[model samples]
Target: MAIKEGLRPGGRSARVQESIHSAVRELLETHQRSTLTVPQIAARAGVTPSTIYRRWGDLSVLLADVALARMQPDGEPANTGSLRGDVRAWAEQYLDEMSSEPGRNMLRDVQCSQTPGYCVAIIGAQLQAILERYPDQPGPSVDRLINLLAAPTVFRILFSAAALEVEELHRLVDIALGQ
Candidate 1:
């Protein structure tokens, strides 16, 4: 029994870590970043502040990990033969993913003061990946169109509860393509 117990990886510590992370994520999704605190998270996780500090070092690091986990890299966009189709499809995917609870919480973390630099870097990488996904001659035009369409959706995601509907997407496409 002792050997079996010893052989069990992570034992209680791993469960504690996962519980803390899940609690943090839940708190972040429902509450503003400013409201998130070590004690609150620890209480929700049923652990002590010292346990969190010992494992993650600090609140910022712990929050960053939570945000990163929530923003797990989505698969790259697919090529649909035409830039317009590709851009629209990409926009759809981006909106769908970013509308999730974790995604919204990730945005909150980025906009909050805890890790502005890290957030900028992450957003930049996402933008660059978006640009790279559609590299064709009218590339600049397509990129700009994508930006114009995405900006408002991003605004809504960050600032309001407005859902991006298919009609809005179609309208944006028309405006972007001058149709």
Candidate 2:
């Protein structure tokens, strides 16, 4: 049998990772993030500090990894009758979520991690599901929709102090749909 080099889901490694993620999340809820150390997380997770370091390289990256996992949607995007409707619905929902305080923090964490664009891929999957409804007809690419919709929404979320308006989000959907 071939050997697996790293973490694999639903296996022993997954259990360790999940434990670590849980520890980090739990600790963050109870204590200041700045106060947490790798050893504390390792102790809470029932793993060694070296294990966390070997898998995640550092605490910041580990935090980012956990944040990204939390950001995963519970379900696929809602199905609307038309592409425009679906895209708008998804965009509005995305703006609502990403503009929130917790969402913004998660967004920042994943950005600082070794991998960027993990969030983009999550959105792309949902967007692709929406596009599948219009298979016989031509529609905007997922990348195009992301650019015209998610990118701007995330920009306002991360940088702007004010909340993003739904009207502005729909306008982005319109631009993506070329309307």
Where is the poorest 10-residue window by lDDT in model 2? 1-10
Write down the lDDT that model 1 would get. 0.66
Candidate 2 Cα deviation (angstroms), residue 15: 0.8
Predictions in order: lDDT:
0.66, 0.83
**Please, what is the TM-score per model?**
0.57, 0.89
Error of 1 at 151 (Å): 2.3
lDDT of 1 at 58: 77
lDDT of 2 by residue, 70-90 (tens): 877899888878889888888
Per-residue CA lDDT of candidate 1, range 37-142, in tens? 9999999999999988876667877776676555655665656766667667767876887777656766665453343455445444554564566566344453
Worst 10 residues of 1 by lDDT: 1-10
Misplaced by over 4 Å in model 2 are: 1-5
Error of 2 at 14 (Å): 1.1
lDDT of 2: 0.83
Best by TM-score: 2
